[model samples]
Target: MQIQLNTDNNITGSPELLSRIQKVIDHELRHHAASITRVEAHINDTNSAKKGEQDKRCMLEARIAGMKPLSVEHRADTVSLAVSGAASQLARLVDTTLGKANGSEKGGVSIRHLSQNEQEE
Candidate 1:
């Protein structure tokens, strides 16, 4: 994945940045894989369990694998989605913080108690 940083704003990109991103992606992938593995293993472990869920899971896995599934693509997509969500959350936090700071300076809300509020438009 071509990760771009705003180099003009002193946001220089480096190999270390790429490595860190890779690591984060890897960790997220591991979590996803672990969950799927756990589910499949649980189904297998419970020999006398309901066959419906197991069959569904197996079918799901089969369909996914049939789509030329590589664990890497799944991992990358998962990581990208997670990072996007986190960035969105962080942006909201920053906007709220700045807004509250401005408000407090004008004798509105108290800066000391600026916990997460409702999402602003």
Candidate 2:
């Protein structure tokens, strides 16, 4: 994916150059994938969610770099991240509201305590 174009932006007679670049890209991909898998496994075994997130970030960055033409390869990751983030935020909002309602109900208290206390006179 390394654009090996000269100043003229032409790939003319660059077959060998492209082959060499492909080999480098292949090696990087293997290295990145191995590291990513190890990190993922370690993260799965961890109880600390924060640490798991950090590990994920590190692994993703390595994976991105290992991708040839990183700028283009990362588009999928970016879109997925945005979608997941939005969904998570929405879920948190719903959970917070439901939890508060549940807690208030369990407290046995309401806004009309006076009538229930028989002091309406």
Off-target runs (Cα >4 Å) in candidate 2 are: 1-77, 104-121
Over 11-96, each residue of candidate 1 has an lDDT whose tens digit, in order, gives 23466644554454334334233222211100111223333322211001110221232211111123234343333333334334
Clashing pairs in 1: none
Clashes of 1: 0
TM-score for each model: 0.26, 0.22
Candidate 2 per-residue lDDT, tens place, 1-121, comes to 2223121122132556445433433444442333222111001112223333312111111222332211111111222332233223323333343335456543344556566556655
Local distance difference test, per candidate? 0.30, 0.29
Q: Candidate 2 deviates by what RMSD? A: 19.9
Indicate which candidate wins on lDDT.
1
Q: Give the worst 10-residue stretch by lDDT in candidate 2.
A: 37-46
